[model samples]
Target: MPRQPLVRPGRKLGAVALDVSSSHRAWLDPTRETYLASGRTLGELGDRIPLAKSKLSELLRGVGLYPRWEVIHRLAAELDMPSWPLHRLWRQAALDAGKAPEWIDRSTRASAATARRRPPLDHDGLRQLVEHDYRFYAQVFLCDDERDIAVQDTFAALWLRWDTALCSPDIRAFAWSILRATVMARATYRDGRPELEAAVFDTVALQTQISPSAGAARMTRLVELFRAISRLPVTQLDTMVLLHLCGFTAERASGLLGVPLAAVRADERRAMRHLESAVTLKPDTEGPIT
Candidate 1:
């Protein structure tokens, strides 16, 4: 009946709004659906969990500090749903919510000290999948040893939570989330958004030898596209990077991203739509987005 400590080490009463990421919403949405399906009143569930109704409301709504995995485990058992998937989803959301790595380690099979010892199955395959995607994307922002450390840290985090990765409803999405978090943590940002200026010069830049007037015009268009692309959600941004900048075919991108073919196309469409609306390059709406 007593609310577990409302504040924990590294999590204060009024931290910034990190819980609004799509990853966090996906993490909590299933539990909400299952709880609703069970048709149980908040009072009833609260009583079973032995937490105050007010505290229960916050957890269900994903308000305040991130919910402890212990509480989520209890809630899942009480609801008669498997907790493993939720456990994986919860940690994805936690990373997005700015939970410290040490804190995340506590909710897993081992503490940070021993977490890296237990690598999950298909270690090589998973590592290659993640490493390839990371290197290509991270090259946009990181270089040399920086990129290597970023990749190393990503795999280390994966090793720590490989069980959860395996149990997730979508292992690909879960692993991708970890990679995104790792790279974004160290990426350069402009005005609080990812600074993707490095990418502007990657695939589609102006001719090296052009008249000053024409070059200036082309450079302006590139900057416009750059700003728009930089502001995209990471989901669409990843797709754009692969399909446009890296020149991967959509099928190849689907394979590389470990998402459905439809998902890859949908991301491409959404990103292109945003680009078209945001930039009037060459005064041609029919021009290529890439």
Candidate 2:
């Protein structure tokens, strides 16, 4: 009699074939040597990666719905390998294994609100800017109390370093750096990439009045646009959010981000080009932008 493979639950819907799973496992084959360098039993590898034996076997064998990108990330760290390349493979495998875009999107967002521990302070000069920036963070993080904490921490850090920031060539830029770092630290990551998936819905650019039953083609193109916006380069993403969502001028965004005005414009062009490519991806299926 022939041997049958183990069936993973939740994968019965558009599940990936066993060979695809095996190939993905083979791609991570190096983890075996990194595990023991003399080859490793699944039990040994599981303990080394600090994963449950059953779960580890499922991942190593790709016998289940693909594990979350974070799991692969942790495994990479355990193996002392750079995670970026592995991240790409993990994403490809997930997509090829029939993970829906919606599923992937949900998996990529932060599961919980961020906790910012710093207490708030009153800074007269930065107060208005802080309020404005708070709205931006609120839109991005989409959590009430926790998003407030993130903004409060940014302002508090800036106030503490006010003197140092004042002495810098660009105080706003210095403050911007602090804000950027803090927000990124709290941002959700997938396959080693920080994600701003919230921009798909909450961003001001998405505020146009369009009904649910709007033309099917237009809506489809709109969906593609949202997808592109969510994946822009970090700098470009920030630029678009500032310009369209936050109503900031190019000069103002340049000041807040510490990027030169020319570069900011360049990123805008690049972002638009990327969007164009995505929306026109099939050409035949493309619809009017307006």
Candidate 3:
């Protein structure tokens, strides 16, 4: 198959010619030359990077698509090029493609303004916040032997940076953001070590204390439900917990996760379906007879 040119030469969007950045083109030139000099075809490059041929072509031309950070990083590694230049070029391409959202700019400005006007949180208030949210934080970061350490580190970080978090107009949203960052950092640090990430569902199930008002059967079933929830992907599990357990609205979850509202809704739906299927398949040994 004939390889497509990176940018459609002389292509116009509507009546106006697409504005291509000279700097981005210049930055991409060395990488492009190296790939060709290596005698690798576009298809070969795509196969190596595991990107679609069409997508790879668009990326090479500095037009059409703005790939995610991982994709840019992969291409840079494959081409033996510096990742910083590739990141710059990809960001430029995204801007030229008009793919950058308006809200991103507005949000940046709003956050700056909020930071300027917000006051510091008092020590007592910070302590209260940590005490109230510790259980939820434990559940969020519950990985094998690291659970207690992760929770302690997260709270310590929160306490240290409570003033910065207080700068947000919504304190809860700010707290959630901090928690999400802490959990992600801990997860990434342990990414390749599966033993470290040991199945948390069983541990979480054991730690859950039943309420006195609940019957024994009801408590057993509740534990079973939590175990099932713990089996979900981290993103889906976090979304479900934030929405149902933490009593966050979809909008709040979206803000905390730094994802679109639609994505939060979709994750919630998928999580619920997964939990429903698990519950349906399990023997009803613990539930009370109707």
Tell me, by lDDT, which candidate is best: 1
Model 1 worst lDDT run, 10 consecutive residues = 2-11
The candidate that achieves the highest TM-score relative to the unseen native structure: 1
Candidate 1: which stretches are off by over 4 Å? 1-118, 202-214, 283-290
- Candidates sorted by TM-score, best first: 1, 2, 3
Give residue 224's error in model 2 in angstroms: 4.4
Report the Cα lDDT for residue 141, model 1.
Answer: 60
Clashes of 3: 1
Better of 1 and 3 by TM-score: 1
lDDT of 1 by residue, 1-290 (tens): 21122222322223224545655655465566556555566677779877877787777777777777767777777876545445655676687678987888776643221222334458657776557766876766666565675666566555545555666767777777777776776678888887766665544322232234556557667667777888898779888877766666889777656789999999999998988788776643123354
lDDT of 2 by residue, 192-259 (tens): 55554555445554544444355767656655565566578878878876876565678988867776
The CA lDDT at 233 in model 1 is 84
Instruction: Give per-model CA RMSD.
Output: 9.9, 15.9, 17.0
lDDT of 3 by residue, 23-98 (tens): 3443355455545544556676679878887677776666663445566556667765544434444444445456
Q: Which parts of model 2 have CA positions greater than 4 angstroms off?
A: 1-123, 212-224, 278-290
Over 4 Å off, model 3? 1-136, 139-211, 281-290
Query: In model 1, what are the clashing residue pairs, if there are any?
Result: 1-50
TM-score head-to-head 1 vs 2, winner: 1
Query: What TM-score does candidate 1 reach?
Result: 0.55
